[model samples]
Target chain A: MSARTYLDAGGRAPLHPRARQAFDAATDEGWADPRRLHAEGRRARLLLDGARESLAGALGCRTEEVHLSAHHTASLHAAVLAISRGRRRIGARVVVSAVERSAVLAAARFVADETPAGRRTAGLPDGVDTVGVDRWGRVDLDRWQEAVSRRGVALAALQHANGEVGTLQPLGEAYGHARAAGVPLVVDAGASVGHVPVQDTWDALAADPADWGGPAGVAVLAVRSRVRAVRAWPEDEDPWFPGGVSVPAALAAAAALQAVLADRERADPDRRALVDLVRSSVARTVPDVEVVGHADDRLPHIVTFSCLYVDGEALLTELDRRGYAVGSGSACTSGTLEPSHVLGAMGTLTHGNVRLVLPRGTVRDDVERFLHDLPEAVAEVRRMIGATGL
Target chain B: MVDARGLACPLPVIRLAAAARAATPGTVVTVWWTDPAARHDVPAWARMRSHTLVGTCPLEQPADRTGPSGPQAWATTVVVEGPPAAPPD
Candidate 1:
């Protein structure tokens, strides 16, 4: 077998060189709690403050607006619950795009169901008012306007870009509709923050450090001062997150963010071209396959396709045998073999789906090799399933 | 008639493909599938192989759950038009 190539880089990017350096330096110095009064605590405080400032500068938000959390899902839950709770007087309803992360949808559902009015009307059409999306996974702005304009919506949640399908949402218009309706929009920028340019299109933004070559322990949640977030959890010294995150991890995440951003102008175009190639190549070579995202308006590093008459798990196993690690969006690949809600929401084929996310330092030849092997792997899986001679 | 009611993705399509290969032209094969993946794949397979997909609708969940109709399966009717351009499966 050839050398193993890592193409499943969605939330598993290898740490950036800068992140490694930052982590090493911060580990020894930032071991103490920032809230403590000792000399060690002050050193840790400086690291945490510096990390927040750099992240704030990157996100175009005030340092005070930025808060560290345990992970991306934690940040999203906090944003959705806290913001919705803060504005409960307006209404307990949360307007969210259908294709937002499951965490966002679950958070919205929880906030709606937890309320007194919601308990009575839970699971009703008015509960967690969900806006639908197009076949390409773009949320319908017209429906969005109507959902947010409804009499009792507290907040809205939408992802900046979908990580699974790599489709970018029209945030400017989505945010505008919510703003006009006096609703705060919480944007999950996990998939777009490092790969694509961050747009000023959210009232509350939750970014995933792990998505951008940072460690997995910390995530960035920035809430604009104007946005009301009624601390959902018990009020502690740190209102945003009770225990706080690893200061060293936060610093390393910041450093990685800076590194990826600095290299964006040089890196994104190449990544985009490679993705475009992957998209076209899959469509051209593989029969009975549907490339599921918008061809033009998508993330620079991710692409997803669904193949008919093949099992995703089998195909992934075949590719693995061929020395390539790719991601899959199929029921068979998921431990429970449950269908993907993302694909289901788009009304796209959810079986035999393959997802490839090119890491920061992905090589061209490996991609070419994967493209060459994909047709055979797909064909083999198809044949194994008695779907041959097509 | 093919009842693919309980199987997930490739199985439903594979069963339907088997039916198409065995049947002569003008044979109408009905497959009832409950898995969501088959909802898209069955139609796609029909279109790809030139089989005629007559129509589809939700199965009234049996008043009581029982039997091999894959679980909440919908009935998909397809007419075998002819052999596909490629070699037989």
Candidate 2:
């Protein structure tokens, strides 16, 4: 078989050429301890500082605000916990959008469970209030504002974009609401940092390298300068030191982010057009499909759709067999196939789901071929499952 | 008993709730669901319907036989001690 066109950037990104070179160089020269005061340590610290500055520049924040971590999930856990703890005196509640990443949800559950027994309420046992989303997977602003404005909310989480459906959240509006309510916003930009523009409007931000063709095992957590927490990290421990992320990985991530951002202005239009091609082509060719997400307000690189009466896994297999690598967020079981919470909240069909994430520099030819092949894949899967209403 | 092993949320709870409604009082019904959300949804459904959640046992099955993202499936059993306070209108 010939090479397959990889379209799963949400899962893992193909590293950029510059990122690979930077990784090699940094690994060769940055192995010393950055905490030491020796000459070698000074050199290591300089590299670390440079990486932080580059990442901070990408995120539109000061260098001192950036803290490198081993993974985006860790940063999310730590940030949410820290922010929640910082406001513990004011309130124990943590407000979040219904479609947040699993890590955020898990961390919220943990925090709620840790609340003192005397402070727990019946419906608010977890002290976690979830704001719902619209059918397009975008946060419902009115509902979100109401949840954030609740009397005891400590922190609120809203991702810049939905990794599953590619819906872009209204970060500015959310930030305003959070500010008015005296709550801090923690924005997870893992899916949008390298692919689209990001801002430092939130009180905390979490971004990973995998979304922007950077090396894995490194993520950046930027907490605004004045935000301090007594329990976010142990008092004796360095805030960024969670077993120490690889200096080389951090440098590579920073380099990849800067390289992507530099070309974003020139490349965004073409990238958006390619993504639109997928959206349009899939709709035109595939039968019984409902195109998901906000067509105009979504990420320019990702699109998702669902087919009625079809099995998502079967369709995914057919697409893979046809030399197109895609992803599915469908929850299908032989007994009762369910869609993801995002689709479920939107009340959309969950079966035969397909999420296509075009890489930073995807070729038009491959996208065209994928468009040409997707209909047949869906049809075959539909036939295999004996689905009607084609 | 309902085997919801491959089903996700709302589905597992839906099936289990239906089984509880149809079952005789004081009978235990086992539901096998794969989605992690079922762990919460199932118990919540039982509580809302005034049923007793006996216990849940995690199923150890191979990943392939499970859904696409292979992981452990939950086999939870709940006992129905009374009828639903109000049936769907």
Candidate 3:
């Protein structure tokens, strides 16, 4: 396969040709609702089931364990709402990392505000609590343990790896903490699934195969049978999803996961080298740029840096014009600017935050081009900000 | 001058309010900040309080030069000319 160019892995990577072939094949089939039980529906069901099975096999879980959803955000909302409904009899506190994806955070807030006045608030309900993360984006385990030690804490959600900075969390330790406290843990593996091994410690795990070279709009929520969580809505009652599932996308997700895992051993080392190249080059090329994340204990394919005196929006735009389709708060949010929450949580500078997430089969030439182009981009942004003296 | 650097949300605005009250009429007060939200927030704050924004400048380099991680790193400096009010006693 030929190497395609992409500077933004957070949004979408250029689809691997083989994965693209599989995706094209999967989408070619008619869009029959899998629930109809008719011939076409049955075929859709078969594709859905095959996807669940392949995804489950790749993750080393049962086929029945996988629940497909539209995207990571939707899966997170469903899981949070499901857990909240199930644990309503107990309490409504949803302990989560302060730096969790905004989708999950917003859902928790919605539960808090919309639930009945006399009822418990959505997040850290009256008796519940929220925990803060450390500079490295790891939940302060000691603090989490302290919070969970208090009785009646119902549910906990933490990401397996941070999305922006790419810092891997202490999920195994968190799993032990949640287990010891008798609280069910929901791990958001959206950023970690195929890149790293997800511990079976989670009561429910949320992942997106696209993060590992899979198709978009397909995500999984793995709920352990031992954990009984009711769906928060009528639409979420399907057993296959424990909530409703998207069958076709699920099939594609499963295929993509299988492909990525099979190729991981060969791809990871190369990916890591690319990450290192970006990290080292940024440090050397851009003066006053702070590289954020756990330098060693992080996702092998992601490297993030914050360039001082440069507006993130301007920097991203310049990079885009230079043929590097990079991501920034400026681009993602359409220029209604704010510093990245992940960078803010890590206590790093956020003026010009840029992340380099390497797609599979990323080549030496692409990395070199990015390295050569990025410094100029940063310098241009700095000049525009009138801080060239620095 | 108001030192709002390292302060989180709302605090910078709060400090700006307090500084505005303490300044003499038409005196230019610079608010040093690192919060990205401030570019929008500070101007909104100045407008709300009816203060004239004289100019805005990036803190080019600290009087004491240091690495990026130190005090010299941030990129925004907001200058607000105070309203017609006497200095706080």
Candidate 4:
């Protein structure tokens, strides 16, 4: 266990120490239903409101604009569906980057398919429009403009950064186009909220607690008051999220965000350097490997690469045997029949993929050791599948 | 012709490369690949091996529909460019 290296903290991190402490305390003070008029409920509500304010301060939004959801995907689903419903008088067309998370894409498609059958075009799908991306996994701004500016377009959603490839999108430019079209833009900053400076360029934003070394039960969603978004679910006392979120989880998430923000300026650059080291070493030492995503315009702590003539699962297993934990976006390993939409949309090789997300405070020596073992692991995986000497 | 349909990932390209290795230069190696990775990996493998990815065309089912792992076939053709195989005659 002492020798093991974990680089696969994709959307979840080990709970921050401060977060653990906060969660333990909140478990006691924040356990009430938070809806009753009783004193216990008032205490829970206070804790919940305080957490919301903390997240809002970190996100650069108003406290009222920030709300908590059960998890990250729920926040995105509500953002997509409610925005579509709110703008129902307008056409149902929703524009999303090709590299958006599967949850976002699925929700977009759901609302698109919900459009009246007669309203749909003969060949084209009416509800959603997908904009293609470049080989670097960055969205094509010109194409995005064309899509968003189309008549009757309801809303647009683009992730701040792709978790799989670590490529940061041109959110400033993309958001500008959406604004000019009078279309609200939703930014899924789940991958960038804690690791990078999220621009205030979004009309609505979704963040993941798991992404910030917090407890996984709560997620943050901030919607600008003018996004024309209504609750997607049935009318309830709590419109955004019907059932209240766990107070303890919300408090833990808040504490973790504050702790991460305080240390990020000092810790992020070191993580960036370690990632750069792995990028250079892997490309230099390994043969037929492609280091993917934008070279400079990317998340600091994430690096992804694809190896030719190697199976993604086999390579992952080989690395696991060496006590190195990594991630794969390849279809065989992704648990989905299709490979990563991010890598596929970028026209990159999707097999033999490895995604390394360095958690905060990852030691440099651990990364170096992993780099030392990576080449041999890839070579051995290739050889096992009768792919050697070709 | 090699049928790598239902095989995931590097298997498709690996099989293609293995097939190309036995043929003389300019011999065409055809493969039916279902794994979506072949769309990029086969071309990538061809370029890395100095082989020619001559033709590619989508077959029966388009790969975009997400669900269980099954054959989502696409026919790909690569022409060999390396030296001839060892003769046993």
Candidate 5:
């Protein structure tokens, strides 16, 4: 049987060939803990440091600023927890963009639970603030600035680019707003690290290696040295991430990051072209399909669209059956059966949302096949829905 | 008949199971659904319970002539009848 081709990189991107080689080579050696002072531990630590240095160089950050974690989820959680700790004196609230990953949203919700009975917390964290986004998934800077001016916000979290719609946030504007208010900004760069340029306007930034063709588990959280350290629970004074990093995964992640970044300048045009093809094809194929994201400012390899009168989950399955893997907002947010939080925040159609994220080795033929097959799949789904009177 | 037209995954399965229990042997339970996973899920659920799948069809036609959103369009509609055999022991 032939291997399945995955078009849903939003869920997880495939590992790079070089990354796989690094992983295979270090399998036995990466088993040891890096904290131990033994020879094996020292070797593991050296590998981890090398990985960190490579990733840091790609991100245009310092080695000391980058901390590795289990995955993007862990890194984001740790960063959010740290920033919200002991900030009750400033405000019992946290401010986060509505389009953040579920991990960030959950962390904010966790902090919100800790707030002391509604003294006026802004965001998800107790004493934090929450902000909304525009139709293109950009944070409403005017509203955000207004809220910050009124309250002494503790930490502000905004993703560099939305994972679903691929809309690039105004990081420079957001960072300036937060810095002017003396609040630290935590930027989630998970969707746009090597594929797109990393914006350096935030106090701290978090990225996943897998997004850039790296290994899945390794994530980088970059913290400026001068920022006040906010530690997550478990009360580890040393560092929040006590689990010693995996040297091989880190090395693989670094290798992937360096490789993608080195080739980004050349690969970007092709990636953008592919995305445009998907965008135009979907628009032409599906009636009332609104392609989400900024046409120019969006990520090169990602495209999202919402189909009216079609269920997102249903569309995904139909596409999958046709050998085209796609992700939907409905599957991503199902507890309430509402559209994607990002789409909701952006005031876009949420019912039939699907995000097509291209992998590094994706070819033109596959895209053509997907485009050719999508309309049929969508029509099949809509027909199944009994969507009448439309 | 259970209407789970706009529901997501697992919910449809859960609802189908609930409806199935209320049905007697040889009862035709029509499930209206929009989830694409239902194409596989409805059949899988029916097979697991030893029910007989009667029919599955799309609700609407596609707007486009070619592409993924083509003529075989529409979400799915599944009809299953309870088995004549004994229920789970």
Candidate 6:
């Protein structure tokens, strides 16, 4: 018999071979601080610059625009703070979609929570304006336009695609409104960059290395030349700021991005078909299961659904015991024991949520095995809850 | 009274539903549960069964219930009126 299928790419993907090689090579030769004036430092600096330039090529931005950071969450918080601070003189309102990543939403809320109502807080945006999303988790474009058009808007945030449901947002419309308002648009491409084509129009973009099979602990924050984004932490205090990016992780990330982009065209359709199969099969086999997100327009490798009678945590545990690894954006899994904000915003069933993200090189057989095991797992969870009949 | 504590998710609601069905008319069924989902699921179940939600409050550890390490902790106490308007089909 073949090996048990591993279907939990949404949690963290297996590292790509090229990324592994690059990271291994970098640790030996590129460990020296790039800011030092020694020969070893020069060698590390060269590797770091090369990685930045390579990532710049992939992202359609200049190497100088890319600032490597610790991770996606930190990068997003820094970017939001910097961009909002840079435009503080113009306004103090930062706007974001309701379905944005928790990092983005939290950053906005942090700033809003710190200050008094209608009062400008130094180094922080005053008020946060949230734009609602449609039932499919797409930002309501009309509401977004209205919020971004407000005279006191300092910055606006919209993700290229939602991480939980895989729904792609209308970034172009959000960007157009931001441009008209003379505000910088920050796009979190953490979920879409390596899997799909990310446009060059957004004023600022954030991406994580783990999204493309690279190692964790590093992310890229790229800002357009025309956009003014000041670093929340100065280089003197934070050595890893601006040009002090981790050489090894950055190099590995660049290699991984190149590898994924090279074979994306060939692998996209195959992976997408597997995802579609899961979406259809789950709905077909699992009673009262609601598949969330756009039917046609979504990330090629991600599918999410909510089972009505199952407990999210129990169902996750059952799948794990059956040798299938999956993740949930549900409240029970989120440590808060509340429903998924993405599902809640869409007015969809938030309980028993399951998200499946296929990693690169996933075969149809593996996906098929997962599909075969899922209904049984759901049924087992329901039975445990004394909900066997339903 | 149903002590559904230490159980996760739909179990609490299922037990509550059963208790609500078994209780006589005008009697109140109090369900002590640990799972947070009961905050919403229990209320929804009551409304669906056409029972009145007497109230819901934070529950403290029961005086008689002691754990091996210490006293047990359960967070939610959901109260519902008994005798469903319609059969629990």
Provide DockQ values for all models, in the order shown: 0.40, 0.04, 0.09, 0.53, 0.03, 0.19
Off by over 4 Å in 4: A118-125, B22-28, B47-52, B59-72, B79-89
What's the distance in Å from true for residue B78, model 5?
32
Give candidate 4's error at residue A23 in angstroms: 0.9
DockQ of prediction 2: 0.04
Candidate 3's TM-score reads 0.79
lDDT of 6 by residue, A198-273 (tens): 9876998998888879888789889888987655566662422554567898999999999999999999999889
The sequence of per-residue lDDT tens digits that candidate 2 reaches over residues A1-390 is: 788899988847899888999999987788788888998778878898999999988889999889888889988999988878887777778888888988998888888878887666433424789888887888889988889888878889999999988899999999999989888899999888987788667888999898889988888899998775545555543565456677788889999988998998889899889988888887788765678899989888898887654566777778888888888877653233444676666656565678888887789998998888887777777667544332
TM of each candidate vs. truth: 0.92, 0.80, 0.79, 0.92, 0.78, 0.82
**What's the best-to-worst order under lDDT?**
4, 1, 6, 2, 5, 3
**Tens digits of per-residue lDDT for model 4, A35-91:** 888999999999989999999999999999997899899999999889877887778
Q: DockQ-based ranking, best first? A: 4, 1, 6, 3, 2, 5
3 or 4, which is superior by TM-score? Answer: 4
Q: Per-residue lDDT of A1-390 in model 1, one digit per residue for the tens?
A: 569988998877888889989999999999899999999999999999999999999999999999999899999999999998888767788888888888998999898778885535553333688888898999999999998998878899999999999999999999999999999999999988988888788999999989899998899999999998788568787789998888899999999999999999898888988998999999999988888889989999999998987898999999999999999888888876457888877877788889998999897888999999999999988888878864
What are the lDDT figures for the candidates, one per model? 0.87, 0.79, 0.70, 0.87, 0.75, 0.80
Model 1, residue pairs in steric clash: A331-A337, B5-B69, B5-B70, B6-B70
- How displaced is residue B38 in candidate 1, in Å? 2.2
The numbered model that scores best in DockQ is 4
Model 1 backbone overlap count: 4
Q: For residues A71-113, write the lDDT of model 3, one tens digit per residue.
A: 7888888787777667776666667787788887877776555
Tell me the number of clashing residue pairs for each predicted model: 4, 2, 2, 1, 47, 1
lDDT of 4 by residue, B18-66 (tens): 7887888988777998777788778767766788777687666645867
Give TM-scores of the second chain, every candidate: 0.77, 0.76, 0.70, 0.76, 0.67, 0.70
lDDT of 5 by residue, A1-390 (tens): 344557888637888888888887777766566777999878777777788888788778899888888888988888877876646567646788888998998887777776665554333334446788877888899988876655656678889899899999988888898888888888999998888887679877998888877877778899888777657455542375776467888888888777888889999999899999988888888765678889998988899987655667778777777677777776433545344677667666556678889998888988988888788887787678665333
lDDT of candidate 1 over B1-42, digit per residue (tens): 787876877788888878888989988787878777777677
How much does each candidate deviate at the interface, measured as C-alpha RMSD after superposition? 2.4, 9.1, 10.3, 1.5, 12.4, 3.6
Between the candidate structures 3 and 4, which one is better when assessed by lDDT? 4
